[model samples]
Structures are given as C-alpha cells and as structure tokens.
Target: MTEFQTQIQAATRIVQTVYGLSVEWQPIPGEVEVVQACIGGREELPIYLTQSGEQTLCICYLWHDDEIEPSRRTELLEAMLDLNIPMPLSAFARVEGYFVVFGALARQSRPEDLAQELAALSENALEALEAFADYLKQ
Candidate 1:
C-alpha cells in the first residue's frame, strides 16, 4: 500500500478509539467539500482552503512524493479536480514524523457523530478534542 493509504488505515484504528466514531472510508463524495482549483502543491503537503464559484469551504491536498516536480500554487489549484481526496478523511500534519490528524471522518459523518463519540469519553477526552477543535477555529 502507498504510505498515505497505510497512514490512513493506521489512523482509522487509532481514531476509532480516540474519536469514538467507527469510520469506514469510501470514495470522495461529489458534492461535499468540492475540490476547487488547486491553490498549491508540495512534496510535503498541500493544504489550502478556498470558496467555490459560490462561496463555500473546499479543500485540496497534493501528496508529498519524491518523484514529482514543483509547480505554482495556482497551477496546482487549477488542476485540483484530478487529485480529489475522500471528503471525510482526517487532516493530519506529521511534525518530525509524529502525527496530529483527526476528524472530518466518514464523508457523511456529522458533528453529531463526534458529539456522540465525545459523550462516551470520560469528560477529559471530550474536553481535549474540544480544545483542539477550538484551536482549528471549527
């Protein structure tokens, strides 16, 4: 499996316990977080947020790989439709190889799902995730 696919699988097992929802990854939904033009691409990670032709939240990622050539963020954004990620996938950053990715799980999973998952935790986990979300401005 590719590094990302493996990371995703491993992340799923970890989040199932920490996030409380049982997520099953599926194809990227056509309507959810539509992949607008690529704002950028990187060998590390391309994380960008933009509005649709109608103002809305859309995100795009250009996977980090050694074999790819560098290109302008705008060029990447224009070609983004070809690099759609499953809408519900967790967004994580690996700093020094340790990750902090979580949430947006299961393209169809709702905030309520996360809320319910929080309900199962022993108060502290709930607060921790909440604090993190707060940091994300969610």
Candidate 2:
C-alpha cells in the first residue's frame, strides 16, 4: 500500500478504537484517497479525510448550494466568516457546490492526532448544521 493509504488506514483504526466511531473507505474517483468516518453513526455528516503532499485534511460536507435558503445566503456566509476563527480546529469553506467544515494537519502527524482532528471536524460539522439550520431549505 502507498504511504498515504497506510497512514489513512492507521488513522481510521485510531478513530475507531479511540472515539468508537465507524469509518468506511469511500470509493471517490480521484488521485487522493478518501475515508468516511461516521460520527455517532450519523452517516449524513460523515467526515472525509485525504492526504496529499505534506498535509492531511479532514472535511465534512454540510450542505449543497441548492439546499441553501436563497434569502439567507448572505447571512449564512457572514455567520460562517464570524465562526471561522472561534470554531477550534475546523474552518468553513466551499468546495465546488458544497459547503464544508474542515481541518488540516501535517501529513506526518501521529495517528492519535489525526483521530482528534477527525473528531473535531465531525463535531464542528454538526454544530454548523445546527447553527445554520434556518439558512437551509428543509
């Protein structure tokens, strides 16, 4: 297995054992390998991890562009910007058509550290969904 894949596998095991979360390898068609870690079995807000070069990134997709409440888009954007600094290890970002919460660590970080990052990212994602519930379409 490649170094990146091996690191992801180790981090997955750490997350499972330390956090008691379920993790699945996602078959995303791309150069970067991805892992989906389910926080409290809430598959809808699974954290996705990828390692490239010297960094490992964990991301959680909060919602899609079409899911946003049209009138509240500006408010949501402003709120996200305000929350970015105070949200611990995670930050709000737009990836293509999706809104996401993400964290990054050095690629050579310990498995335990990666696990913590995944956990933090997962928590931030849930909080983002809750905080922005009114900004999204039901």
Q: Give the alpha-carbon lDDT of every model.
A: 0.32, 0.84
TM-score of 1: 0.23
Least accurate stretch of 10 residues (summed lDDT) in model 1?
34-43
Residue 36 lDDT in candidate 1: 18
Clashing pairs in 2: none
Query: Would you give me the overall lDDT of model 1?
Result: 0.32
Best by TM-score: 2
Task: Using lDDT, give the best candidate's number.
Answer: 2
Q: Stretches of candidate 1 above 4 Å error?
A: 27-138
TM-score of every candidate: 0.23, 0.87
Candidate 2 lDDT by residue in tens digits, 48-79: 77777888888888899999999999999999
Evaluated at residue 13, the lDDT of candidate 2 is: 90
Task: Provide C-alpha RMSD values for all models, in order.
Answer: 17.1, 1.8
